[model samples]
Target: AYGFKTATYILDDGALNGLSNDAPIEKLRALEDQTFTSDLDFKAALSNALGDDKAKQYEAILVTAAAKMNSVLILCGILLFVSFYAVSIGPVMWVLFSELFPNRIRGLAISFVGLVNLTFAFLVQLVFPWQLSNLGNSLTFLLYAIFAIIGLLFIVAKVPETKGKSLEELEKLLVKST
Candidate 1:
């Protein structure tokens, strides 16, 4: 629909003027900006207007444009998702790990916890396709959302504020809280 709109808009402004296919293309275009009910109707009109081969070429161009634009949109959405995770979840998770563990066991704890985190991340990637196929999109995404909400609750109820506090201070604070 978007590509059709763009193609029509371009064609309407005489973009294809003075060309060899001008008359036939114009014949297929809407004179009074009418709506096409379906592809069959449009194709039949185009075939009557300009024959099969020319109509196919025009349709191919429109379809290609729409497909390319759709791919670009999907790419943009993936980028946006990554950017949101980077800013909101990724760094905060590592910072929390650093602040939460005691100095005596910090290195070993961080290494073990980081490995476990990576393992879960790998598992999620591995299971995502299966979940999507079996549970469908809604359930898969809802499960992710539920887990995210649960993590948020855990952070709120359990993770202590390290704001304006040194590592030793934070360690002491956590010990006292526990």
Candidate 2:
């Protein structure tokens, strides 16, 4: 009953979110292709197969594996945090980029930055999967740390403060830089 309810909820939600109603059937077929056991009672059978003593040993191994995964999890958490901060930084950078240009060139400057952002985003997506696969966990983290540090430095050095400044005042600041 619970499984049926969950499946119905998922199907309805997926349809509402613009997924085709065929999604659930396709997913089920994929699971069948992967040779997953279709028995709804497999949970009970699995517990019976393991027995109590073996289950305890299995649990201990899982705990040790989870402990080793802590570093990777922490790195992932940091990445998520940094990504959130970057989202906040984006608008500020855009505003500052806009302010740095003369009125006649502001649109051009914005378009240039937008293109650069899009290019980098595309490159990041292309590279990141290979980096994770080839570099292993620690090196992948080291790479992210290096990039994060560089981003922090760029923000500090290249980004101008724009808080509470009028567009005319910002223009004066940019003009003084020339």
Candidate 3:
């Protein structure tokens, strides 16, 4: 009348201590398998699965079960999303950056600015995992969305249109007197 089709967690140790239930606490033996009821009455074994790292790993458990969807579908969706994001945001940014500075310093300015942008992109990639783990997904994504809105506002107000204007005109409009 028992099966081991999968790993069923019955004993809740650190966080599981919150639940209190019991059938026969006094007569229970050490060999008895832990039951998976929300209530835990009998004293649990002193052994800890988290072990020495329990303090760090005990925060919040984020369970990600594998999706049953087709692999092709998942890959196609990701590719489409990335393609749209890049096409929508990438070229415009390069074009605007190329047009921002005056001709005299344009090459040097773009290189320096591009380096700064690359650094920030690397930082975002590095910090993203920490943000998701510490702040949770909702707040982490909200932070990025807020920054995106602020960037949009700056682009609209500060960045100029390069449609048909010559480099000289843009230099006059954007560059300031020392």
Candidate 4:
């Protein structure tokens, strides 16, 4: 299973091959540079090549069967856990972006945020292969996890809770008078 997962990850064809339980860590560490015009294109290619839906179903079965959790299980668990954060963060960021700016400049603020978001997204795509090759998977993901924790902390500490507040109140709470 470990070998299969590693093959799915690192192989050129994105298929399970030449994998074994005792395969060297170097095999997993090896990466290749690839590019796509957009994230959607990359995702579509990955889903087609790697059969991500099949992986998801396999993971679900493994979880439901109460199998002995192995490396794949651990990785999948981490992936799913972070996936929850990914699914939640986008809408939260959008809502926060929309709410934080005053009505007078809201559109401009959103446009700015969108530009920044896309730029960083592009940068991540550009550097991810280099990060995987040079930093290795553990360190690469460690940095992501650390940053995610920091982001969560920042949101908790700095983002004002506007759940019960009216829009006008939120504007006053979030936006400055100036």
Candidate 5:
């Protein structure tokens, strides 16, 4: 969720900053044509440009870039985990709340819950960059921690167990008064 929100924010900012979407599409098409060229052609071009000693230097740069790429991959993995936790916990809490409500109000309650969740999500996307810029990484994470704590508290207080119940049983259970 965070990753998706970040991407949306970046794209929106790019549009605001006068980045033409078609420019990237055109650039990608040009890259597709170059990708079909043979490795022999690429090697010959490289050899002509770099000679021998410069080629060794280029190889060293490639190795350095490769090492940095590993660190990049690790950071991407951590971001993926954060996104998974955000999306998973939000739905789990929503489901738990829905199960606790009576059948007649469950749909309305779920819809209201969804609206609240989406509003927060939209605000998070809009304000995250500002938060990061002003508060820095530690305080940004602290805000998320506060949100998680509140959400957990709400879930513990209002959610009822649905474990080991069949679909019909759960439905009937929800219909009963708490």
Candidate 6:
């Protein structure tokens, strides 16, 4: 979308004009007739077509498109996080908490789990601003992606199969006698 938007903008403004026949913008001008297999392909081709000086002049255009794209991506991320929390994280914890404990200590076990969850939530809220300010958007998001992958690995390795098991069976599988 960004590449297409850029191509359209350049085409509309006649910015492709008056270049020496060998310039990268001239190559880009030729590409205006061809179909790109993917957005990345178009972007790569556009980058290849822009010489350093031309690319510098086009920086404002790319930055404007990037800002809009980042906003859209952030909105989508928030929506996805909310939906995932609603359907997965929020319920799964309670289910796991229920299944992991024996009847004698279920209530206490769940209270502990709930307390941990709340504490982590508060810590996240407290640290998020600092993370964003210190790491910047790209690195902050990269850190989130890394943590999500680590959590996924932990779930795969540590979480027991409880689908057909009773709470007692799950407790037996998940908990060891001390």
Query: What's the TM-score of each model vs. the native?
Result: 0.55, 0.54, 0.56, 0.57, 0.46, 0.57
- How many clashing pairs does model 1 include? 0
Q: What is the lDDT of residue 77 in candidate 2?
A: 68
RMSD (Å) per prediction: 10.1, 15.0, 11.6, 12.5, 15.8, 10.2
- lDDT of each residue in 1-178, candidate 3, tens digit only: 0111122334324324332243222222231345532111111222232332432333222011111124464457457657866885566776777777777787998899889989999999999988765564446656776886798798788767788988787777777632
- Per-residue lDDT over 1-178 for candidate 1, one digit per residue giving the tens place of the 0 to 100 score: 2222222212333333433554454564552243343334444555666677877667545323222124454456457758978896687878878888999999999899889999999999999978754564446656776897898798789777778899999888888988
Give Cα distance to truth, residue 99, candidate 6, Å. Answer: 0.7
Show the colliding residue pairs in model 3: 21-41
lDDT of 2 by residue, 1-178 (tens): 1121121111122222343343233322222212112122222222344554543444333222212123455656677867887787666667667777778888988999899999998998999877644553346656766887899899789767888888888888878887
Residue 102 displacement (Å), model 6 = 1.7
lDDT of 6 by residue, 94-166 (tens): 9877887789999998999889989988998899878754554456666777887898799888777779898
Winner on TM-score between 1 and 3 is 3
Task: For candidate 2, give the lDDT of residue 68.
Answer: 18
lDDT score at residue 93, model 4, on the 0-100 scale: 85
Better candidate by lDDT, 3 or 4: 4
Per-residue lDDT value at 74 in model 4: 56
Which regions of candidate 3 are displaced past 4 Å? 1-62, 66-84, 176-178
Query: What TM-score does candidate 1 get on C-alpha atoms?
Result: 0.55
Query: RMSD to the native, candidate 4?
Result: 12.5
Query: lDDT of each prediction vs. the true structure?
Result: 0.61, 0.52, 0.51, 0.55, 0.51, 0.60
lDDT for position 32 in model 1: 21
Global CA lDDT computed for model 2: 0.52
- 1 or 5: which has the higher TM-score? 1
Candidate with maximal lDDT: 1
Model 5: residues with Cα > 4 Å off, grouped in runs: 1-87, 166-178
Q: Which segments of model 2 are wrong by more than 4 Å?
A: 1-67, 71-83
Point out where model 1 deviates above 4 Å. Answer: 1-81
